[model samples]
Target: MTKMIFLNLPVKDLATATAFYEAIGCVKNEQFSNENASSMVWSETITFQLLQHGYYQTFTTKPTADAHATSGMLIALSRDSREEVDAMVEAAARSGGQADVREPQDLGFMYLRSFADPDGHDFEPAYMDMGSVG
Candidate 1:
């Protein structure tokens, strides 16, 4: 069986979070979504489970971190080309997300840019040219 990843994120509002994910090209899997959560599919093997803060707390004993003020993890997504990375960031910014949370990086073979969703979950969209790598 192929391995898959499900990233669970605590969100402030389900509707806004769902819209933001959709704007960035994720398809919502309504079969797995409800009032308290949204199952956003980024690709065949990756899905983001956006859970409302109250509902999310039930999953763990620890308090949910205020992502806007605290950093927990940074998710990096691979894009096919540099333009694709830029497009995703642009889409994110237009969809109520903050673009360029960190400075863009270019190292010839690889290019990366970062953004934060409305809830402040940081994501880095990157593209790497394998042929250009030493």
Candidate 2:
């Protein structure tokens, strides 16, 4: 069975990416954080690999996300509560990320907010009360 998940992404600056994830409360894996890439551990099962542009090209044939344009994908993290979702989004902005959405949404049962990293990679933080997952 698959037990681990690796989310590999490209970033413009390794240091900035590292700082952004750290500000969002992720502890980096030192073993994988180096000149070319860094691993941000979100949980026991989730890891985000932020690679330098040159290094990322070694693995994928597709072009990298344009820092000034829209991304083809959006990364999302699930939070325990609406407050947690807001905190993460706020933290991202404080750490050089931008709010992908103008404001957080309150849908009675679910709350969501979006943010984009310095390189323009999109992300979202969502919270759904266990009783509301329908």
Candidate 3:
């Protein structure tokens, strides 16, 4: 079996978070989703599990970090081109997500833009041109 990644995140509102992800091109996997949690498919090998804060706490004893209060983690997704990266940022803003979390970065062969979901989880959409790399 191929190894897959499941990134679990705590959310204040499952529906809103799920919708935010959907609006930005992720598809929900109903097979692994429920009222308190959603399995958002980012790629064939990557699934992001958005769990309601209380539901998420059941998974571990550690306190759930308040993403809005402090930096938790940054989730980066790859795009096909620089335009795609910019488009995703636009989509995120239209879907009630916030951009300007960090300044957009362009490094000739790579481009990145950051946004925060309604729950304040950071996501960076990036594009890289391997052909342009020296």
In terms of lDDT, the best-performing candidate is 1
Stronger candidate by TM-score (1 vs 2):
1
Question: What lDDT would candidate 2 get against the real structure?
Answer: 0.87
Q: How much is the lDDT of residue 72 in candidate 3? A: 68
lDDT of 3 by residue, 9-104 (tens): 999988889999999999999999999999999989999999999999999999999888899679899999988999999989999899868899
Please report the candidate that would top TM-score against the real structure.
1
Clashing pairs in 3: none
Question: What does candidate 2's lDDT look like per residue over 8-123, in tens digits?
Answer: 88888999999999999888999988899999999989999999999999998888768557658777899998889889988999999997555777888888999888888788
TM-score for each model: 0.98, 0.91, 0.96
lDDT of each: 0.98, 0.87, 0.92
Candidate 1, 22-124: lDDT as tens digits: 9999999999999999999999999999999999999999999999999999999999999999999999999999999999999999999999999999999
Colliding residue pairs in candidate 1: none
* Ranking, lDDT, top scorer first: 1, 3, 2
TM-score sort, best first: 1, 3, 2
